[model samples]
Target: MEPVTTGLIYAAAMAAIATARPKWEPNRGNERQYVLRPADISPLSDFGIADAAVYPVSAAQFPSGVDRIVSELNGYGKFGGDWNGEGALAPTAESVKEAIDFIRAFPAGLALPSPTISVGGEIGFYWSSAAGYVDLQIESLGHASLYIRNRKTGQDRFDDDIDWRTVGRQWYQEKLSILQDPLQIAA
Candidate 1:
């Protein structure tokens, strides 16, 4: 092959590789996001799918709180096309695991509330419960946030750190279970 023709072929191959490669950009909190084709994450190991202790949450059915959240997670970077122009990263396995753990621990006796779920930034999820009007933040790599309104005052408080066993249990047992129950009001 002529030297010039060989050089041209090499350039073409390099260009093809570059175009096919996923674009990596910095996402929330110093993490990197690959803005590329979405991966199929259907058979997640966690979310109680393999565990007998908790009921499995699947992404097969559309619009279910759990399903929607899972779907968003699986399509994190691909869904919104470099969302917010920051190139949002996909949810980490840890974050997804944390979310599932929280849901699996839902008190069996109480009616599970349906949540409006969405991916926040890259490493976490936002869940809004219509029943008690509660907002839940599930963080994979950092602290999670939760806000519950004081029934009487109707004011909102934000807590970045939540103790699932103590404060969480208190909210579940003391306030959310009973309608119009006063929030403990984390100070």
Candidate 2:
């Protein structure tokens, strides 16, 4: 076969493989359709809030009650108070609120311990929200890590590290529209 024909065949095959599988489409219309079990809510109240405002909780508090709550509610393991590294809980409403509170309380900034998987460096907490489940994107020395937590399971199955210089510049430009003062950048 000619080289051009072979290339055409390969491209066709790649497209077929890419579209053949059913995509995992999340239901963004109504969330109630996915019911939360009673067991899920029980732990939320039990989670101790003692030092939740503090990021990178001491080793003594590893797998804190808050972590347990996050795990039980989301059906996954959470790194509770740790933020620098792998986090114990997925970014849920509760978890995001906790993170926000921590950030607000420590405006000066804080060090988040490395989580489960090392990204070869550290990351600074920036913003978090629930996209599908919990979405946390942190900025580090010169890179950014995007973490998406599972909604029902509270698991971080999707974590990607990107070069800040390449992606962040574009992202910042787009995000600036949402801010009142685009010139004001957060650390």
Candidate 3:
């Protein structure tokens, strides 16, 4: 085959593969794919706050949650009126980046699930699990308000000002126990 023809065939094959499959991820269900990681970009001018209660299924997934939070950072100025709608706040670039850094800095020794990222008017960024959640409110560079809550036990605690790095995984280990499976709860 001519060189040009061979190149065309390879290009077509690659496109076909991309269309048929997304990258795979483990520790997640087989359905997992490279849907997250490297946040997807959209026109911030068009970005409007949705009913945050129903978080996107994509944002609920692994690293995808990280992507969603990062992408939404531009929403900071989207709300022309009071940015805080029913307690819905846009995330600041600093806080969003810090939240991500906190997740990355998490102790590898802990098997904590990836947190679903959410925003609040009062809070800057939030990382949550069925077990517990953390709130990060950005202050000056390298400083933030950190809050942790045990959902099931209703143990809520926070520091109005501190560094996220100061939090230890052992604290989360204790909070994780508070999360009981809903199925288990039903039984």
Candidate 4:
């Protein structure tokens, strides 16, 4: 399957949300969570807000692509065995939640990474271009693996068992610097 662009994902989400109505409910910590349900579907009892990808209204103004990523991950979390008709394993709820948290905390001004799910059910995000490539795989809530390749300098770095919660932003800034300008790093 061809990789889906963030723009396409955003467009599709907006189209779907266009016909939906918002219904608000109080969640943990008294956050005002709202679900965008289709006009035809009545509001159902809330079982798991996470399962529904419901978020507080304040986060609705999140940067572009965040909502699309959340929607995509939620759909992936609902899949069962052989979700792809090719024996691909479905991602666990824990992994999905981890991925969502990581994405929500991503630094601003950088292009949103492309979210991917491994056949073995791991959730990951990657950025690739002629300049370089970077991949971050979520193993659990705070654990992950990172792989970076600099085509210009022929340097490859892989770090496993990383705690993203502690240093994800600063660490990615250093690694992704290669993507911003491979020549500068090569020099």
Winner by lDDT: 4
lDDT by residue for model 4 over 114-142, one digit each (tens)? 89998899899999977789999998758
Kindly indicate the candidate among 1 and 4 with the higher lDDT: 4
Tens digits of per-residue lDDT for model 1 on 1-187? 9999999999988784423112232113323323322342244466634322333332242243434444444554344434555665444556656665665455444434443335354334332343344556765433467666654556676777765634554566564532343344333
Winner by lDDT between candidate 3 and candidate 2: 3
What lDDT score goes with residue 1 in model 1?
Answer: 100
Q: Estimated TM-score per prediction?
A: 0.41, 0.21, 0.38, 0.62
Worst 10 residues of 1 by lDDT: 18-27
Could you give me the TM-score of model 1 versus the true structure? 0.41
**Higher-scoring candidate on TM-score, 1 or 2:** 1
Per-residue lDDT tens digits of candidate 3, residues 17-85? 423112322223324244332344333456553322222343235544334444454344344334545
Off by over 4 Å in 4: 1-63, 182-187
lDDT score for candidate 2 against the true structure: 0.37
Residue range with the least summed lDDT across 10 consecutive positions in model 3: 18-27
- Give the whole-model CA lDDT for all candidates, comma-separated: 0.48, 0.37, 0.52, 0.76
Task: Enumerate clash totals for all models, in the order shown.
Answer: 0, 12, 2, 0
- Which parts of model 3 have CA positions greater than 4 angstroms off? 1-63, 77-81, 84-93, 103-123, 127-136, 148-155, 166-168, 175-177, 180-187
Ranking by lDDT: 4, 3, 1, 2
